[model samples]
Target chain A: MKENYYQPEIECASVETLKALQDERLVKQVKHVYENVPYYRDLMDKKGVKPEDIKSTADLHKLPFITKADLRDAYPYGLLAKPLDECVRIQSTSGTTGRRVVAFYTQHDVDLWEDCCARAIMAVGGTKEDVCQVSYGYGLFTGGPGLNGGSHKVGCLTLPMSSGNTERQLQFMTDLGATILCCTPSYAAYLGESLHEKGYTPETIPLKAGIFGAEPWTEEMRRDIEKSLGIKAYDIYGLTEISGPGVSFECSEQSGMHINEDHFIAEIINPETGEVLPEGEVGELVFTSLTKEAFPLLRYRTRDLCVLKREKCSCGRTLIKMSKPLGRSDDMMIIRGVNVFPSQIEAVLLNEGYTPNYRIEVDRVNNTDTFDVYVELSPEMFSDTVREITDRENKLAAAMRTMLGIGPKMHLVAPKTIARSEGKAVRVVDKRKLH
Target chain B: MSVKQISVFIENQPGKLAEATRYIAGHGINLRAMSIADTKDFGILRVICDDPEQSAEVLREGGYITNVTEVLAVGINDAPGSLATILEIIAKAGVSVEYTYAFLGTRMEGAFMIFRVDDNAKAAAALEAAGIKTVEQSDMF
Candidate 1:
């Protein structure tokens, strides 16, 4: 029997109905932004668009695209649609880049955001009977608070165990028989390793499903974590700029994550030209928050490169699906005139039977690109002699060259030399700036 | 017989060796013999210590990647051609050495050479067949 899940009315809406909802929300949100947020209104006016010009989703292209730079310039409250008294909370980006993005949420906006997150939890087979442990970091970062609210919405026993304190995380997880795990994929992988170190097998853990996101992780990592934890690992994709991590989530199908069309309208556009691409064409993912109150981002460039699919999902949700992001256009590195992404390097390492704990160091020495990859040797490979280890490194370099069209100097480091993270793992270190 | 050799990976940076030695010394471990094999990026500090397990544990607690390998320790007279004699015997037996390091023995007339051979058992057989005196872990400590 098909199990009844949460938020069926919106999730299982037909295409016509979903489009109608998007059109209604898009029209209202456009007018809301145009009237209230002068920063976005100026951009719209510059683009020769008025609030009346955007009557439906069909006129979405008429508005100007908002990039992270625009958001950075706007900073706090520049893009806020609602008044400051109406806002309830704020979540900011890690500011790893130039400037941090602060997104505001009114109580209503938080309710809708949590509703989207509840849909994500339900997609992963979450219910009130299950114990849901949210391990994503809380405060400022959208990961923890977003999922925590969603878990509450699902009426599950929620453990707001923010990131860190692994020992306590495991203790509560085991003692409470937590059935659902949520956090960054890297943290999930770390927990898997820790569990093994503590001599606990997958069967000993009560977790049945994991909702992993907040960073771009490869499918190879998904399989590794699944094997380690004995749980179906689901990918949840969202950005703080777009209201944290409930924009989309993978269902039992696991092929792609179904975007909550009622709230978010996703589009793919050519990264270089800014021209919107048709469905199935891989390009930069752009999202327009349809129903956000405080910050209503329209045609916001996400910088993530992925494709979209409208194929019938077996799970019975008519929501459109977005493929796992291939990589971020902003994070793409051009080494020796060739485009390279850390995800590509990660895929190569995992394929060659190496753990995903590898670091890529790129530097310009004497006007030449010096690319070096330091990979942690697995236990089986650790026993190899220096010559044998060098041979393996050469083989890896050859494999990377075949895959990436350019060879990287591979160095085999001892296991665990590379730093692991409780959040996003730092995979690439570009030393060109120091030079 | 094979001697336990604890190898620690140290970055090729200033004071790394000193830091590792300080940690080991703080644990009250004494190195009986030691050698450093270095590359441009990093170095492997291999040592035969009074307590191999305890020394490795101490270095690991100091955040070093330490591995214990079974290495053959052979005694050779401190004279010209003494090292070559053992190498010739092992080569004649079709055994290959991965790496070798030596230090003055805890005696007057000879030095102790550590052999990391491709096959520890095969190397031990070759040395025994040639009537060479091999040092065991107990003998070294």
Candidate 2:
């Protein structure tokens, strides 16, 4: 019956105190970005704004919104606020066919990001005695490093099983008795299904809680994953662009994820007009990295569509809660914890001497994203032997994996099998009910 | 001598084999001998047909991935040791049999064995040198 929190004062602070903290941090962050990041400084200067123009969070709306386009334009080094020597690491976005946005982090930034994640793990019942297994894809991907560092900070025996090799995941989970699981919802679901298929019930499995995120998942999926694994499924949200998977997290109540408002400030804006929306009003989620040294973004638009609620929580954390992202304003789809764009697929097809006509079918099978890309086959590409055809398909899949980071099932079908669109082509068919 | 054998690439889903068979039958191509080697994702449907070229052409027109493989059709005598003798000769000749199946030869024989061997010409030469008659395409068609 011990009420637990990693950093009680910060996590359970009053809304007034949190607001004051955000305001103080926001003031310092604006000056930091303006001084160190020429890219952001130019952006602010273009809007005829200065560091002294911002006083508090109320003046946050005066700043120009930073979009993904800006991130792309800035590319690898334009937005880097600190010097390379001062920066400890850089995590690049999994985006294809363009210059990837690289988010830089100093050691201090890493510590804060991990601290945010530690609060998340603790909220989900992580303790010093617990063995936390982090199954997120490690390196370049934020899901693994963020949670793994947090687990270490929480004094849990960190199991850095960086995704895939499900057999080993199970072996270590049962043999080592991993008490907490950290990974995407889809992967967690897959693990649960795998364990059950191996005839291990919830009671036999030692895992008590799971923190799943990076991709959107539904409540039904949560319950299904929870039931299968016999663990409470908590959602954690973050983007590599915003220091990755520790920005917000869910507690025991699981109503919604609490945004770690101390390090990062959350805002919602009408995407089309760039006007701030009131609380409870659903819109595009924006973030401002307050304490980050190497990368401090000011009012950075997330492109994710979700609403924020400041109502009282049963978990007793006063952090502002963001509902699960309703959907994205853009065509970006998160499949198996990877950001996939139709343009990336199109780029692959066009580059590989294929027709633009293709169908991308995405579905949740056993809580894992099943991605199938059916490319319309030209007559010349047609073959009679399964061996030759499968070889060709595998080669295409390998190319896609190189481009997408995650491999897709390549199915070369008849030339006219894919339905031709009249007005516009509907390329991606995402069947996951994450909204 | 080697005869043409048709192999179709098919996904491992229920009714796919049926559909492929029906399509072949509808095109008036007779399946003389058939064998399906299945993997987790798909199945390779191989068949000795009355018209291998026509079957392949029709299947390709139907948008099915198909390929033609050359295999030997050896006529086995009506004796227990006859088939064993042919296998022993081929095994000694250093030619590997990838796969094999049987069908009644339309033109002749007690039993005709379709041998999908690594070296069909070599196996055929060994069979011929051993005094075993290998059926030609006309015999199966």
Candidate 3:
């Protein structure tokens, strides 16, 4: 068997060599941002700093932190390092909260992004002979095009199937003999359910591996997807602002996502104080584009909470490894002074063998946030008696109490009772009636 | 006589019917007669109730995930060949019946058969033109 394409680069590169490469790229990136992007220059000047004053990665801390609100304030192209005419492509955020923050990419930037994604694919033992099915949607949304370009660059036959229309996607997967699949983790679960509904087995499609990302998913979800699809699932992390879907990826070992530190610098910092945190501790993830020319962000706060490890991975990659993201800093719900994340609830539900179709109803009852978890029983578990249903609901409540440290009222609903989102799942429904 | 019937997609598990009934009673809708067609994965709960529209609304409000489908409630004599006559009329109209069940009318003088046909409007029209008493939404309950 041929060795993995990324193995040699990861195994052979020394710590000294990797640091030297990062230092050179950091200097060049700082100079380029100061000269080309007015936003960086203005922010740096306000802090009494010049591009030449910064020397190494340690000096990067003196710079002001860039928040998502800053990106929103700048709007579409105010932060681009290059003019719009020179840009080759652009990708936009979902804009679920506010205005969409668009990221521009020049031709060289696009090539580098594709190269990183190709390296990621190769880390999972993907070969040129493999057929990759890109189901992440092709539009201004970055995922579909990013994976499609990378798969093509890796010399694989790429299928840009995009998202939705599950039946048609399955038909193509079977007929095309796709070997590698890429999409959000939630969609993979839905596809698995669709396959079961259609009476198809795992052998029906020729899928050996899957790269799931675009939303925060738990380890339980990973196992569920792997078991349902009968394929090894790897997590890929990226934001459109930095580079599409190839900022970092997990190797076949599945320990942590290996960051391409040569192109992008990863840091974990205290989200509240903007103070840098020690490695191996969970904090907000921040990234700076070292090689991107079109839109090289300087210390962009990703709002995702995760820990980083600089020790070499078993895959032999000198690149830094980041633990799977826990949750978004902004999306955390404080219920009765207890911080709760929907992902935590999802993990508990999966472990209890319940389908992950649940809605968290938080209502202000008697001046307190009362939580009601409306969970839908699987079609196979539904029965004709109320006693059996309440018994199952009690079991779910017990599991939630043990896992979440607090148990809310549980309601057993029929299958498909909860509304399904075509994109991201709506996890929180706060009915506090805030005026 | 005609009866108002509602067809809902129910999962094959315990307590689902009781929950549905609780929701219906909470909304003050009376259950007249009901039958369930069960398969391995799903069960179709066909009900002839006093107020079907309100009953469906209550089920939906309680988050039952059901769909309201129009089914024909034909008055069949409690004798042999009565259902055959209605099926023959429906077949002649090029309508295919998916599944069906029988229910006792309110007065107990006759039997009413609920037919879940592919084309509800066409089948109802054919049965009415053939002089069979086709139940309407208002005539049910």
Candidate 4:
């Protein structure tokens, strides 16, 4: 069967054709970076490699990997491909460590981004008739505008509702007969809570599909969100540096997110050794934008670690599918010489009937790493006595020990006592210096 | 004849009530009488104090959400049927007492009871017309 959606020349393009397209684009991007971005030029010169040496996509391995620190070094606007006036739109990522990293996009870049988004929407069986309610934030963030423009490209009735104001979001979802919703998975969970509070059920909102991403979510959360909202939740993945939230998407099969390989090449490489790993092997994900115009990336190492599967999907797209990112390299906490991800703690907390609000404090006591978890009890569990609380905390400690190989001291705090962020939740606080 | 009353919304927890009372006491607000109406989720802490304004402000600022309401502080005789007489008058006037608790007055001749009803103004007026003295904010403080 001939796939109408797949571009014949690109999707089924021969290796020679693919390499030619990549080479042309790669050379242009390299020259652009060398002329405009001093960071990339200096890094390339230090590695004793010239842009011409990267003649094929496979030769991309010769290029130095660009890390988040490189982006930080460049800071705002230091990596732009075009002049400031030519750039039409910009999006920034919330830098947990310092100032936000801003990405620039020309009109052409925006069109390509929207096309990628439209493809993502189509992957999940969304059509022009579907009403897309975009609940992702619009200002300074790539999520809202990226999905909004893409939904528009797909000829859907787009609602750029943005985030928060749950009452109004529900009102518009019901009033406007919205069918597709987009937002962070956590916000989706909160929306489910709001719907229950207002005595509304799955039948209340005309939602049939959801594209959730921006933050790490587990399969358990996906199930909860799907069951609560009565919608098929598909994971969409992207970063502002690459082109925002339409870089890849999960189809109706829910197998994995299919990367748009024609535009962006996805590679899994061993994070420690920087060696490319074979398909199905878990490693850090790296991408080289083959079609991006405004700020084409060359081997940008997204610290997100995941595996890729090249088997043909039931969705008939020849693109590569990536398993959900486990966690960022920087997000992994070394407690007592054992690596622990906050997501693991979160999963344990969710199953333990504790509220998701939590804080992890790491200190050095007696010259050893002492991990203390401050968990907020749910409203139902607030009345538990000190004995009961201690028992539950001990149970959590045991579970953490079994799961993470390092037991942390548990501190039960009152509900809503932990600080809440309007953006990403800060998970780790290292206080070894105080010791 | 008058007594101060304060209403507070307290989430049902082990130490919330103690914490609220401690906060009020720390602010120098003398507790006159208190009662509570509780469900599984939350409880209403109804308190009569010597300084209603100060008590309410302290509780509110301390994050113990509370409201101040006027209630009749009738000097009921320290004997049986005195409480029944006041309640009967309220029931006859079509007012339902949601909750009530008593505290001994400075003297043994009377007791001050704090009542929480649906209609505070109507209950106060009806009790006053029945020859009962309703407390003002200044009278108790």
Candidate 5:
């Protein structure tokens, strides 16, 4: 615990101390948003809530909840809690589904965010002696900047590789003896394959640990990447709206990520009702940025589906832990009175010896939702007879039915027909939305 | 003896069979005989071709999913009930025939039938013992 934890005082803080800190920060943040941001102020007034109404974290439910739709409607400066001159930087999400989410940060907010990231790096055994390579794309993307700042705070010699350039990436990784690799899991998998093709085994890989996130990856993939890259891959969770990639991180226990609850208060709520669920119940994740000064959000609905539990960890940190997000609520589709997530289909596909890359096409005809998934036929799983191939397709569909509680029509197409995911793969094509 | 046959996976759409066969032909591989076993949405284009291993590899490089299977190449009388007789022998051997197609490139006079059975060794032995001529991989080329 001495070398593992970065801020033992805050990380290992007692429940009472953590609650008092959250109650204080939540009160201050509500007041700050109510006084400065008119959008949230208007929301509060509509809800008949005032800054005085929220006295502590217990009163957090009294405040109006903000959603992604609200953020988009607020657009540029509508959600700002501070003046433009005082703000230091603004990071934006790719915003593939909706309008870009631009999060503002003051110098103090940046420092606190970096501190959160530093705690993550240290949780994965990152140190000043380690050469940390940040391969997550920089610019508007928060991954590169977040990990880079954290590496600096930890005093590691930072390599801001900023994604792509595989040849040079391998060169620098081997030559510089980089110990920590920070990137998306897909990129890490690609790098591991490239390294193998270039005659470098997992034993020859210089990285001892990896901080992989910004996308969902299965535990099996994590073990595979760990074996291939010769590193203990760690999961780091964050969103651009909630101060980027250090909002929560995995400790040595590896059960679930310990959310930096001191800075960002994480909660689970039912997506349909907005009722707060009890701890350990899976629901949509709601984050209230308690310490974000420039863009302080109050009970912001993240729409990320997960579970949070505050169990006593062997790592000795009392921060409440959040399970790796099951799937985003936005990615869910209802068919024949049954809800199916594309991630569920993906899990079934992987379990059946197929690649996770698939296209889920959903259409509604005559008031019935038609669900179809196009899974690519890899060379390794090919068979000569139509019965043999059709048997596989039937088995996959049955597994998906068992997993999702709804059966989807399975199409086994030739490989290279489906588009591969580079960063975030668009897996769903919903025709119902079009109509 | 069993002959190597390459099967290419093709979606049941326009020009899929042409696309797969063209890929192998473009790689200078000559096709001997082929059959399409199709379902509602997809089909397997099974082919007896020159250089079966090389043809499958070429199709794979062209991004077509291919599988190689060893099938019995038995030469039978080019008359009525020839296929029935061979299948009866296979059934007597307690071997189930999965699929069968004609081998058009047989250099002899009799009709050559390709048989993919549950147990190739048992079926091949029974057919050969019943005076059916079993072709080898070199016999076609």
Candidate 6:
């Protein structure tokens, strides 16, 4: 949390200098994409814009916005700006949403990506003396390898303990004295619960900090994990389309994640009209990779709805900071004329002292939307009478109703009744889709 | 005196009950009496066993949400009116019974029933005052 913990030269760069650097990179990257990637060049032609028109960040709006749909249309090689021989690695999305997006990275691109991640690790006080354990899924999934490379760049002793094999994760974590952990937020919470079940307290573990991301997690969930694991939990943000797990990271301030503006340019746009929005407005987050060679996405729409902040941070980083995503614009579920994100339900539960492991079941019966939440009770909360338990359910329903602006029927089931996941937890069951 | 009863939370799925019982059986524990309270979405499996501590630990280790509760077990005559008589006595004493389950006692001539009440000592006193024999942990095992 100290002011000069990380690379102060880049993180604390002046706004004037950062903007000038971005202006230079924007001009070169625009021409590079137009000359090499035919798919993007065609998109630019359709917009009646040329690479010369985008001379700086001011003219960035003139370029056509690229989306995941474009990535899918192009498929594997359509977006590559460099030759296949020049690229050293390719990381793909899980294809859970649709077609997997494979991003090619040249050795230069990989080095820059790892440098960004190294800055993140350094921001969290990770040093060479620390043993960093990377628990994100490895291989085609970008989480593990991205952080693994980043931890190495930071000069920390790295433990490439890819996800699962949680028992062994704990063993190595304790045996080797891992001081930093990199994994998804849900997996961090799962590790906390597993440690508690094994009768290990925070003092028994040597982890001092954890960088959790790859999925949207609430601030309340962050606090819960921090308390359970007895360490500071930091949020790291990235997507396969942009880079990997280190596009931005939280400093000791923990207010928001500082975007690596030197390598990527971020903008907010109205998702419907595709018109750019001014700073501080909540809209779709779009990023243009300025330094990536093989796969440089120009104004790629991230689909994550959040606000961008330019206010000077306490950490002294002038880089633009982004709030944790509210929810993906597409993942926002509409039930009974109300917009509900699973995260709102999670925040409500964690505030009410329940674990974040829950299922939101939305159904429609006879033209009416049925919203029910199945919550797994902790062991302490499971022994009450039926009336007492029902009363608690009603209280939770009222709390969620107040937060979500709609009432959802709440069921407090026994502990572990709902499934526990080792990966991204499935939290919603929309039965209306079946009908 | 009260007896130790282990209650586990189980989903109302097809194999949940079998899974829980098999887990306890695998630990070599014998159940003295067992009952399940069912709801549309889930069920609570309550059991009295030869070793309640071990039973709870085994079920918890098997990933079941288990709790140990104190309940008053009363031995009554093996007649139709025996349960009704005890229920009325406890009702008059103002001790509300949250749930109750009965099984044949170790003795052939009578039956043993368990009552999960708000206050175990109060329920035991009320049942004993009415000449009903409230069983102890020793009586069950």
lDDT of 5: 0.85
Ranking by DockQ: 5, 6, 2, 1, 3, 4
Q: In lDDT terms, which candidate is top?
A: 2
**Interface RMSD for candidate number 6?**
1.9
Q: If you score just chain A, what TM-score does every candidate get?
A: 0.77, 0.96, 0.76, 0.75, 0.78, 0.77
Give per-residue CA lDDT, model 2, range A216-241, as digits (tens).
88889988988999999899999988
Pick by DockQ: which candidate is best?
5
- Measured against the native two-chain assembly using Cα atoms, what DockQ does each of the candidate structures obtain, in the order listed? 0.14, 0.25, 0.10, 0.03, 0.60, 0.31
Give the lowest summed-lDDT range of ten residues in model 6 chain A: A92-101
Off by over 4 Å in 4: A1-20, A196-205, A332-435, B1-141
- Stretches off by above 4 angstroms in model 3 are A1-3, A6-12, A332-435, B1-141
Q: Compute each candidate's TM-score over C-alphas.
A: 0.62, 0.83, 0.61, 0.60, 0.62, 0.61
Question: Candidate 4, residues A232-319: lDDT per residue as tens digits?
Answer: 8999999888999988888777888988776788889998999999889989999988777667777898888898997766667667
What lDDT does candidate 1 reach at residue A197? 86
Worst 10 residues of 2 chain A by lDDT: A379-388
Over the stretch A1-435, how does candidate 6's per-residue lDDT look in tens digits? 555445677789899999999999999999999999999999999999999998789999999999877888899899999999999999886332234679999999999999889989988889888899999889977788999998998889999999889999999998998999998776788888888999999998989999988766667778888988999999999988888888999999998999999999999999999999999999999999999999999999988888999997887889999998876666556555344778778888999999998999887553346899998888778773556667788899999877776689998776666787899888888776321
Off by over 4 Å in 1: A96-98, A332-435, B1-141
Residue A43, model 5: lDDT of: 97
Q: Calculate the i-RMS of every candidate, to one decimal place.
A: 2.9, 3.5, 8.4, 9.8, 0.8, 1.9
State residue B98's C-alpha deviation in candidate 1, in Å: 36
lDDT tens digits, residues A322-412, model 3?
A: 9887766786554532345677677778887888899998865433457888777764454433444567778988887665645878876
Candidate 1 TM-score to native = 0.62
Residue-level lDDT for A435 in candidate 1? 8
Candidates 3 and 4 compared: the better one by lDDT is 3
lDDT (0-100) at residue B20 of candidate 2? 85
Q: Give the lDDT of residue A136 in candidate 2.
A: 92
Between 2 and 3, whose lDDT is larger? 2
